[model samples]
Target: MAEHGGRDARMRDAEARVVGTVEFVLDVRVEGMVHAQAVRSPYPHAVIRAVRTDDALKVPGVLHVLTGAELEADPSVDPYFGSPRPDQPVVAIGKARYAGDPVAIVIAETTAAAAEAVPLVDVEYSELPYVVDALDAARPGAPVLHEAWPDNNCGSWRLRHGDCDRAMAEADRVYSGTYHSPSASHVPMEPMVCLAQWHGDRLDVQTSAQAPHAVREALERMFGLAEGAVRVRTLNLGGAYGAKTQVKIEPMVACAARAVGRPVRMELARDEMFQTTAKHAATVQLSTGVRHDGTIVARRVSVAYNAGAYALSSPGASGQGLTRANGPYTIPNVSIDCVATYTNTVPTCPFRGAMTSQLAFAYESQLDEIAADLGMDPLALRRKNLLRDGDVYPTGEQMHDLHYDAVLDDLEHAIGWDRPPEAAPPGKARGKGLAIMLKNTLTPSRSQARLRLRADGRVDVHSSSVEMGQGASATVLQLAADHLGISADRLVRGFPDTDVTPYDTTTSSSRTTYAMGLALQRAATDLKAHLRTLAARHWHVDPQDVTVGGGSVARRQEPGADMAWEELLSAADLAELVGEGTFAADFGLLLMDDPHDVHGPVTVHWHQGGAAAEVEVDLETGRIEVLRMHANCYAGRVVSPHRVRQQNQGCAVFGLGPTLFEELLYQDGTVSNPNLSDYMIPSILDVPEVITSSALESDDPRAELHGVGEMALPAVSPAVANAVFAATGIRLTELPLGPESVLRALDERRRNDDQEGTTR
Candidate 1:
C-alpha cells in the first residue's frame, strides 16, 4: 500500500491495471480426458534391472504404464542452446542418475487412479556408487556418474590475460580464501504443470515455462516432428525467478500423451518440486594481490561447480567461479580457471541472478579487505580501479560505454554515504558497506514485440516475454501507449501463444525494460509512420506535413486540422495497421565470423550499478538484519521508474537470502536440505525497511539501452559479508552467515585473543 517510485501518481508502482483480462476458469465437461502421474527413483544411483507393469495395468481405471526403455513414442530432446552438453531424455534411458530421476510414467482415468497405479508398477534397482560433491567427484577413483567421462567433470570456462606472476611479485600484500556457495530453489507459487496433446501431425502443449520457445524447440526435437507440428503456449505464470527458465515437465507430458494416445497432464507436488528443480551449489577458490595504494595488482581464481547428475545448467556462464575470475573493477594481471564437474545431484539450474550473485560475494568481499588494509576509503578504492568506457575484459570482450566510477559516485550521494559505523552498535555490531557490479541483457538472445493499430485506433501489442510477476508486459504497454499518442489503457495486449508470438530471449539480465523496450519503440514508430501515409492521402498533403500525437495525425502548423485516429483509419479503408520488431545488444565490435570456427569473440556489453547496505548485527544472537538499502544503476534509461524499483527490490531480497541464510546440505551422495524448510528464504518481514533502489540513465550509441537485471545482486551479499567482517574482524568465507555461523566466528575470535593474552 506504501507508495512506489515516482511514476503516474494515479497508478501504484506503475502497475498496469488489467480490468477484463481475467477469465474465470470454468471446469469443463469433456467427452474424454485422462489424468497421469510419474514414478521416480528413491535412490541416488541405481540400475534398471526390470520393470513389471502388469500390476499397474490391473488397477481400476489404470490405462497403461511406461518406462524409459518403452518411451519410444518421442525421439531425444535437445539440450538448451543446442550445445553438445548432454540432453535430458524424456525419461531415464539406461541408469537412474540421481534421486528423483524419472524412470517411468503412467496414465489413468482419474487422479486417484494414477496415484494408486504408481506403486503398483514395480522397478528393480541395482545400486551403484555415487559422487555427490563436485570437488570430490573430480578426485581419482571417485565414483563416476557417467562412465564415458573417466574423471567426472561436465564443462570448463577458462580465461587468461596479462602477466599473472609479474603482478603477484609486485604486490605488497596477497590474500587468499575459500568460499562455499549453496544452492536454492525457484519455488514458483504454482509448482509446475504441463499438458501435452498430439493428434497426428499437430501438437498442442500448454505449460508454465518462463522460456516458451525453448520448450517448443525441445518438444519438437523430442517427438521427432517438423517444427510446425509442435505448438507451445504458455499460460499465466504464478512466478518464475529464473527457475522456470528451463523446461521441466513439458517433455514428460508430451511423451506420456504420445504413449497413451491421449492428452496427458503432469504436475509435481510441492515436495517433489524441491529436488527436481533448484539452484546448484558451487565451491570457489579466490585469491588476490594488492599494492600499498589499494590497487589490485594480481588475481587468480578457480571454481568447482556441482553440475548435479547431468549438465543441465552447468556451462558456468555467470557464476561464483567466474565471479572470482573477473568483475566490475580493473585487475591488470589476472588468471582464472573454472571447472564444472559432474556429481550425483539434481542438475543445477539458473535461479534469479544465477552465478553472478555467488561471485559478487567473493570479489566484493575481498575488495573491502584490500581497501581497509591500505587505510583507504572503500568507495574511493572502487572509484580508482572502476572500469571506464571502452575497457576490454580478459575474455576478449570489449566493454562499451562503461561508467562504473560514475555509478559508485552517484550512490554515494543518493544514499548520503558518509561511512556509517562498522563496529558493533555500542554493545551490538552494526555496519554499512557498498558494492558495485554490471551485467548484460546479451544478444542473439532476441525479444520480439508486435504492434497493430486496432479498429478503435489504439495499438495492440504482442510478445512472448512472460510477466514472471516482474511487470514486463505492463512496462511494454506503457511504452506503446506513450509512443502511439494514446492513453495507456488503449493498448491491446495479446494473449501468450508461441505459434502467434515472436521469439523472446526470456526475461532475465534486466533486459525487458531496455532491450525489449527499444524494440517496442521501433515497432510502434513503424506503425505510426505507416499510418501517416494514410492520413496524408486523406488530407491531400505530403506525408511529411502530417504530425503524429494523441493517436491522431494533423497538419504540422495547423492545430485544429489534426485528423482523429478513427477517421484516418476509415479514410484509409482499413480497420487497423500492423508492424513488428526485435532487438538485442549490438555486438559489431565484439564479434567476427570465422568460417572455421562455429563462433567468434563477442565482446561484452556495458552495465554499471552501485548499492550500499546498512546492517544491524545483534551480538547476543548474531542475527544480522539489513536495515537500509540504496543503489544507483546507469542502465542507459529508466523505461519506467516504478518497474525499475520492483526490479531493484527483487535483486536485493534475492541477494540478501544467500548472504544471511540459505544452504544446500549434502551427506555422502544424497542432498540433506533439498526442501525449503531447511534452506531458508527471506520472508516479507525479513526484508529490510531502508531498502532504496533507483537508476541513472543517459543516451549512448554503444547499446540501445544498458541492461541491469542481475548486476545489482552480485555485490549485495559481499557488501553485507564485508560489513560483518569490518565490525567483528571475523572473515567468514562460507555463505548464509546464519546465526550459528556468526556465533562460531565470534567465538573463534574470542579464543584466539584469550590464547594470546595467556601466552603474553
Candidate 2:
C-alpha cells in the first residue's frame, strides 16, 4: 500500500464538498416538505402575556403557528429543553428571557411565506429589569431570569486545594488584577439547520448535529417516545465549533413537524444564528502570593461567566474554568471560584476552547506582570514553576504524560526568544511574547463503532463521529487502512446515523481522534479474528495456526494454504462478515457535594500547548500588526502529523480574531452587530506575515494519541496581549484589544508621564 498515513492524503469527501455536490441538512428535502420561521420577542426580559397567532394563520400558504403554551398544554411533549439541565423552553414559555427569543413558529409552504407571517404573529410583553453583565447579574439584587435560581446564578463551582489563607499571609509579597473577555459568536459557514418528519408516530430527524445519539435521547425523552422511535442522522457539517454540540434547532423542528403533520425544515438566518448561541463573556479576578525569589506560592482566582438567559453548557464550562484557572505552573495553595451567572442576551455555549481561553488570558498575562515586578525574564520565571511529570494536581491526582517543556522549547526556537528585538519602523515599536496553557478532554464518555467486510473485499467502518470539516472521516479512513492492511480507497465510511452507526458522546472537546480511533482499531482486530476463523475452517487448521495480515490469510505451516481476502470469503460462501467494538473512558465522579472539594481524574488526559508571537505596534495609529506567530501542541503518537500542524495553525489564527478585533457588540442587552458586515473576523489582510505550527511527540512506546484541536487556542490571546505590552509599556486587561482601547491607554500614559516630568 502507498505509504500508510501519508501527509498528502486528502479527505475522502473533499472533492464532493468543493464541487457543492455534498448534501447538507439545508439541502435535504422530502415529499410535501414545508419551511418554518420563528416569531421572536423584541424585549430582553419580559413576561409573555399572550401570543396572538390568529393574524399569522390567516396569511396565504401559512399552515400552522405553534406556540410554547400550546405544547405545554398538550401534555404529550415537554416544552422545556436544554443540555445538562431542562431550563430552556422550545419557545417563549411564560416569559421571554432575551431579545430574539422564539415565541412561536410559523410553518408555511415556503420560507418567504413563513417569514412574511412571522411579523403578523403579535406578542404582548411586560418588560422587566435586566442585567447584561455577569458580575452585575451575580450581585445581591439583580433581575433574576429564573425563579429557581434566585441569585441569578446558573451554575457555580469552587476548588480549594491547600490552605490558601496561610500561604497568602506567609508570602513575601502579593499582587492582584482583574481581567475581562467579551462574548463572541461562532459564525460557522453553514448556519444552524434541522429537518424533522414523523412517520406514523415514529420521529425522524435530519440535522446538522454534532451529537446524534444525544439528540435522539433528548427527543425520545421530550416526546415520551420509545427508544427506537426517534431517529437522528447527520450529513457533513460545514463547521461546528461547539455551537452545534447537542441540539440547536432539532427539538423545535421536531415539535413543528409533529404539530403540522408534515416534514418541517428550519434554517436559521445569519442574524438568527448569532442569537442561537454564543461564547461566554467572563470577568476574572486574580490574586497571587509570591516570595521575593519569584516563586509563586498561592493564587486565588474568581471567575464569573455570563450565561445569557438560559443554562446551555454553562454549568460544565464553568466547572472547567474552575479547574483550569490555575496556570500550568505548580502552585501549592490555590483557591478558585467559578460561577455562571444569568444575563439578558444570547445563551452561551462552549466555543472552540470552552472556558480555557478566558482563564488562560487572565492567568498568563498576570504571570508576565508578576515577572516584571520581580525584575526577571518571563521565560525564566515560567521555567522555574513549570509542572513536571508526577506533579500533584489541585484535583488530588498525579499528572503524567506532560510535554509542556517540549512545546515551549519548540515555540521559543521558532520565535527566536533569546534574540534581541528587531528594529521597528519610525512609527512602530516591536517586541516578542509567549504563553503556555493546559486543557482537559471530556471525561467518562464512550464511543462505539462497527466494521464490515463485504463479499467484494472492501471494508466499511460505521461510526457516529460527525465530520464537521475537522478531518474525522479522513482520520478514521487512514487509521483503518493502516490497521487492516488495506488501501484507503478500499474503505467505505458511514455518516453519523442513529439507526446504523453506534453511539458517540459528542464531537466537541477534540476527543474523536483518540476515542473513535480506538473503537475502530478494536473493531478491525475483531474482524481479523473472524477472518482467521473462516480461513482456519476452510483449510482444516487450528484458528491460532491461521495468520491474517496484508489483506490475506494463510495457514502458518503450509506454503500453499494461503488465500486472499476475496478468495477466502468466496470459499466460505459468505456475503459479508461484521465485528463490533467500544471504548469508554474511566468513569470518575465529575462533581462532588462539598463546594470546596472536587473529584480526582477529571480528564482522560491533559492537552498541553504554547504560543509565541512577534508583534509591531503602530504608535501613530495605535494599531497592532502581528509580524509572525509560532504555535505548537503535544500530540502523543500522532496519527497524522500534517493534520495536527494544520489544526494548530488554524486554531492560532482563529484565536487572533477574538484577541484583537472580534467581539459581539451589544447595545442594551441586545446583539447589535449580528451580521458579517458589522462583525469582523480575520480576513486575508489581517493574517500575520509568517505563521507556523508544529506538533511535539513523545518517544515512550506507551504513549497514546492526544487531541490537538483546541490546545493551541487558549495560548493565542495571552501571547498577543503580552507581545503588545512588551512593545509599549501599557497593560490591557480586556479582550479584543482594538485600536481605540490602545489609543486611549496611550493617551492616559502620556498625561501621567507629563505630570511626573513637571514634578522633576
Candidate 3:
C-alpha cells in the first residue's frame, strides 16, 4: 500500500475520483403537506410593527400564517460570541436587526400560492440610521446598531510577547501601512436549505451543514430538550465553504414544521444567503520597525474586524488574525491589539481564507516596502527572518515540526525566484513575492470516526464531517485503506447523520484531514488488530506474532498459509465488525497553559505553512495577474496526495479572490453589492498556472495533523500585491485592485516621478 503509486498515484487519486454532486428528488404524496414562503425587509435596519396575514389566508391553498409572535421558541446564545448586544432574538420579534431578517413565516398547500400570498402579507416598519463600518461604529455617539453595547465594540483582545517597544526604538527604519480587507459572501453554488420533521417530543432535521452535531446541539439548547432527543442529518450538502458551520434557519424550519404538526423545508435566496453569512472585512493598521539589514526588528499590528451585525465568529477570527499578523518572520519582538467590532451590515464567519489572508496582505506588502527602502532583495530579506521549527508565537504557542524554512527553500527553485524575471514592455516591470502562513488544525478541534467491515469484505467508514468540496471523505478512505492494508476501492466513506455517525467538530480549520484522518487511522488499526486476532485464533499462535500484509494476515512461521481479509470477515460473528475512533483537538505539549485559550482542554499550539507567488503587471493599465504559485505546508502526513493538493489549490484560488478581487461594499449599514454580479471573484481566466503545490511535512508527535485549507490563501494575495509593487512603484492599500484604483495609483506615481525628474 505504501509503494503502490509512490509520488504520482498517492497525490493525484483524490482529485481524479471526486465524489459527484448531490441529487435530490422531492415526492409530493403527503395527504396535506403545505408549502411556505417569507416576505423579508427591503431596508437594512427597521422596526416591524405588525405582520398581517388575513389577506394571504383568503387564498384557496393557504393553510395558515406564522409570525414571530405565534412561535413558541426560546433564543440561544454562543459562548465564543458575546451576549447579543440589544439582546438579539432568534426571530425578529419586534424589530428586524439587519436586512433580510425574517419577521414572519407563511404556509400554504402550494408553493406557487405561497409565493403569491407573500405579496399579500402586509408589514410596516420604521427605519433607523445604521453604521456598517467597524471604525465608524467605534466612533463616539455613532448610531447604535445594538443599543445594549453603547460603543458598538463587540469584543477586544491583546497579545504582548517579547520586547516590542525596545525592538522598535533600536531599529534603523520604520514601515507603516494601513491595509484594508473587505467583506464578501460565501456564495456557494447551493443556497442554505433545511428540512425538519417535528413529531411531539422529537425533532428530525435534514440540511446542508458542515457540522450536523452542532446543529443538533443548537436545537437542544433552543427547544430545551435532551441532546438525544434532537437529530440532524445531511443526505447531501451542495457546498459549505465555512458558511454552514452553525445553525442558521434550522430552528425556524423546525418550529414552522412543529406549528402545523408536519414537515417543512426552507432554502435561502442568493441575496439573503449573501447578507446572512459573508466574511466580514477589517481595517488593519500595521507598523513594522526594521533594522538596517532588513532583519525585522519588531512588528506592531492593530487589527479591527468588522463584526457586521452579530457576534458569529468575528472575535475568534481576530485572535487568529493577531497570531498571523506578522507573517512567518522570526521577529523577536511583536505586539498586536485585535478587536472585533459590531456593525449593522451582516454577521461574519470564517470563509475559505478567513483572517489570515487579510493579515497577510498587510504584513507581506510592508516587508516589500521595507526591503525596497533598504535596497535589499525582497526574497533574500524574507530568508533573513524566516521562522524555523520551535518558533514561539505571541500567545506563547510553540510551533513544532515547523518546516516554513524548507518550504521557502523549495519555492526558490520551483518558481524561478533565483534570478530576476524581465519586466513588461516599456512601462511595466515584474517582481516576485513570497509569504509564509499557518493555521490551527485542532484548536478546540476534534473528529471521531467509526469503521465497520461487512460480511462481504467491504469497509464502511462513518464520520459526521461533511465533505464541503474539499475531498475530506476521500482522504479518510485513502488513509484507512493504507492503514488497514486494503485497497481504496474496498473502502466506502459516509458522513453526517447524528443518529448514526460519530462526533466530529466543524469541518472548517482544515481540521478534517488531521482530526478525521486520526479517527480513521485509529479505526483502521483496531480493525487490523481484530484481523490479527482472527488469524491468531485459527493459526494457534499469539496475536502479537501475527502480521498483516497485502490485505492478508500471516503467521511468521508459515507466511504462505495466511488468511485473506475476505476469509476473516466471513467468520466474524456480527453482520459487520465495527471499529470506533475519537480524537480531541490536539496541540502538542509546549503551550498547554495558554492564557488566551478560553475553551476547555488545552495543549501546545502549532501551525505550519509556506507559499510563494510571482505575477505580471500591465503597467499601462495597472492590471496585475499571478503567473504561477508554489506552496508547501507541514500539515502532518499526506493521507491522499491527490486530495491534499486539490485542497491547497482550492485554498490558493479562494484566497486570491479577496486579495486581488472580491469586496462587500456598504453605505450607511446597507450592503451595496448584495449580489454576485457586482462582487467579483476569480474565475478560470483569473487563476494562475499554480505550478507547484509542494508540501513540507512536519512530524509533530503531539498534533495528529495540521491546518491546510485557509493557510494557503492568506499569503498569495500579499505575494501578488508585493509582486505588483515590484513591477510598479505604486503600493496599493485597498483591495479588488480594480481598474479605477490601479489607474489612479498610476496617475499618482506618474505625477510624483515627474516632480522628482526620475525616469525608468
Candidate with top lDDT is 2
The clash number for model 3 is 3
Q: Candidate 1 has what TM-score?
A: 0.90
Instruction: Put the candidates in TM-score order, highest first.
Output: 2, 1, 3
Which ranges in model 2 have alpha carbons more than 4 Å from their true place? 1-6, 588-596
User: Which candidate has the top score in TM-score?
Assistant: 2
Q: lDDT of all the models against the reference?
A: 0.71, 0.88, 0.71
lDDT per residue as tens, model 3, 1-760: 0101213234233443365424421221334456566667666778787888899889888777777766533243221112222234446666676776667777766778878888888888899777777888888987776666788776666667779999888889888889988888887877887777776788888788887888887777667788778888875456678788766767667777776787777767777787778886888899988878787878898888888777766645666666667677777788888788877777788777667777878887788888888999877888888776676655565545566667667767677887787655676667777776655443666678888888787888888877666766656667677767777787776557898887876887677776777788888788788778887887778998899766778888875877767777676555766778877755531233542442222232346565677777776776777888876565555555565576677767776787776887776656778787887777988788655686555444344455566666777777777777876777888887666787899899889889888654
- Per-residue lDDT of 1-760 in model 1, one digit per residue for the tens? 1112225323323333255243111121234667778888777889888888999999899888877777643344332222235446666777888888888888998989999999988999999988787788989998877777778767665556788888888789998878878776777777787777877878888777877888787777655678767888775666777767757777777877877888777777776677677676777788888888877878888777777877665653423345335777777778877777877777677766666666667777878877877888888888877776666665555556676766776667655678565445555777777887655444446777888877676666888877656666667777777667688767777646788887786766566766677678878788878878888888788999998888778898687887778777787788778877777655521132421121223433555666787777788788888877775576565556766776777778877787788766666656677667776778988888878877665644233455556667777787778767766777778888888888898999999999999999
Clashing pairs in 1: 319-355, 397-603, 424-428, 424-429, 425-428, 510-709, 554-562, 590-603
Q: Which portions of model 3 miss their true places by more than 4 Å?
A: 1-33, 72-88, 531-541, 548-554, 557-561, 564-572, 586-607, 689-692, 698-707, 754-760
Cα deviation of 231, candidate 1, in Å: 1.8
TM-score on alpha carbons, each prediction: 0.90, 0.97, 0.89
lDDT of 1: 0.71
Across 107-218, the per-residue lDDT of candidate 2 in tens digits comes to 9999889988999998888999988898988889888899989998888888888999999999998999999999999988988999999999899999998899999999
Error (Å) of candidate 1 at residue 331 is 1.8
